[model samples]
Target: MALNSKDTAETLILLLNRSGQGDRAAFAALYQATSAKLFGLALRILHRRDLAEEAIQDVYVKIWHHAPSYRADKAAVMTWMTTITRNRCLDLLRSLPPEHGLNEEQSFDEWASDDLGPLEKATSNSEARALLQCMKQLAPLQRQAIALSYFQGMAHEQLARQLVQPIGTVKTWIRRGLQVLRSCMGAL
Candidate 1:
C-alpha cells in the first residue's frame, strides 16, 4: 500500500480505537474525515439529497454507539462504516411504498454514474482492479446488488425497489454476489 493511504488507514483505525474508549474529539475527527465519502455513498443509494443527509446523521449515531464493538480483524474501517450506512438507507427505503420508486426527474444514471466509462480507471490500485475484474464476472443482478451496496452505499430495500425485484431476492443476490467476489479476489 502507498504510504499516504496507509497513513490514512492507520489514522482511521486510531480514531476508531479512541472513539471506542469514549473520546469525543476522536469521534469528531473520525466523522470529519469520513463524512464526505459516506455522504456520497448515501446519496448514491438513497438518490435523494434530504434522505442522504438524514441517513448520514443516523449512521454517525450508530457508529458512535457501535464503535466499541468494531473489530478490525473482521473488516476494514471503511467497509464497516459503509455497511452501517447502507443498512440504514435500506431501512428507510423499506418503509416507503412501492410507488415511491425512482422519480423520473431524478435520473439516477445521470448523476450517480459519471461515465468516465464507469469512472473505472480502477483508481490505479491493484486491489481495485482485481475487485473490478471480479465484479464484471458476476451475474448482472448479483453484480448490480454488490455495486449498489458496496460501491454506491445502497441498502437492500432501495436496491430491490430499483431493480424491481422482491426484497428477499435482492438480498440473496447481494449475499451470493459477495461470496463470488470474495472467492475471486482471494485467488489474487
Candidate 2:
C-alpha cells in the first residue's frame, strides 16, 4: 500500500529498529527504499554518476554492517543514511587522484551541475540559506578551499594545487573557513 510521509516514517522506524536487531529483510527493505535518494545525494556532491552509484552501494554495505550501531535519536534514519552516503562519497572522492575523469559517457562539466531542483529544496531552507550567507562572508581563498574540499569533492592537496597555494595554507584555509562557518551557522 502507498504510505504518506508519516506512515513511511513509522515504517522506516520499525524497519530500522528490526535491522538494528539483525533482521536482514528489514535492512534490505531499508536499502531498497533509500537507495535512490541516497544516490541522488551522492551524485549531486560527487558529480559523477558511476562514483555516486558506487558510493550508494558502498553506503548500503556499510549500513548493513553497522546497522546495530545506528542511534535513532541522533538523526532520522534518512539523515543518518544520507550522512553515511555523504561520508562514503567524500572518502571515495579523496582517494582518487585529481583530474581522474568520469567515464567517457559523462561530460566533465557536470561537476558544476547540481541536481538543482532537488537541492533547492534543501538549499532554500532557512538553515541552508543562513549557511550560504555565512559562506559568502569568507575570504575568497578560504571560501574556495572550503568549496573545493566540501562541494567539489577535492582533497586538501588537490585544493592546494587548484588554488595555487601551499598544502599548509590550504589546510589552514579549510580549518579557519569551517570555524567561521560553524560560528556563523550557530549564530543563525
Give the alpha carbon lDDT tens digit for every residue of 5-36 in model 2.
56776788788889889899998898777776
Give the Å error, residue 12, model 1: 0.9
Q: In every candidate, how many clashes are there?
A: 0, 0
Worst 10 residues of 1 by lDDT: 107-116
Q: How much lDDT does each candidate structure score? A: 0.75, 0.70
User: For candidate 1, what is the lDDT?
Assistant: 0.75
| CA lDDT for candidate 2 | 0.70
TM-score of 2: 0.65
Model 2 deviation from native, Cα RMSD in Å: 5.3
